[model samples]
Target: MRSHEHAAIGALCGALAVTLLARGRSFLEKLALWTYGLLLSVFIDLDHFVIARAKTGSWSYLTRAVRHPVWAFTEQESVFPDVEMKLDRLASHVLIGGGLVLALRPLSRLLAVFSAVVVYAHVLADLLREIEVA
Candidate 1:
């Protein structure tokens, strides 16, 4: 999916968190949930940078992505298109990242649940996208 799609989903997740869990909560608690939802939604995609760095043994891919944040995922041609991009899928869209979020329940149950939902929603959107190139 595109960066705009991610942002849209992230916004929606934040809104949902505010609607479902924010009522009657303390200001800080509500703020935390809202912030987590938005951040975690797109944060899952950070696996792309990690995988690129690990496979390339260089910081160029990561730095370019960080610099051209919008173009990293939006463009058809990548700076390192030949890299093993599928590593990103295994790292984030699968069970491992979700498990990590689940583990966060010990720290804050609300954040754990909200973060899980936001991440899952991100994965669902990616899965549903029309993959013309695979």
Candidate 2:
């Protein structure tokens, strides 16, 4: 999914956290939930940078691709068409990231849950878009 879509999902996650999960909580709790939700939603995509580095052994290509996915997508066919897309390897899209959040929930239930929701929502949105394209 695009950045805008991830942002929308993040907003939704924050809204839900404020309205449903943090309802009746202290102001600070709600604020934390919303803020964490928004940040985690987009931050989860940082996994792509790691994946890109691991695969290509450099960060420059990942930075360029993140800045311009269309160019990268087209270039993939010309330069490395034989290579398969491995976005699915991102920790954010796999159970490891969620498990880490869940494990850390003991530190702050509200923030952890909100962060998990935003992360999973980001993954779900990307998966749905991939299915649509397929």
TM-score of every candidate:
0.75, 0.73
Q: 30-109, model 1: which lDDT tens digit per residue?
A: 77777767777767777776677777888898788778867876783575687866536644566755786768989977
Tens-digit per-residue lDDT, 30-54, candidate 2: 7777777777776666666566566
Give per-residue lDDT, candidate 2, residue 126.
74
Which residue window of length 10 is worst by lDDT in model 1? 84-93
Per-model clash counts, in order, read: 0, 0
Q: How far is candidate 2 from the true structure (C-alpha RMSD, Å)?
A: 4.4
In model 2, the Cα lDDT at residue 18 comes to 75
The best candidate by TM-score is: 1
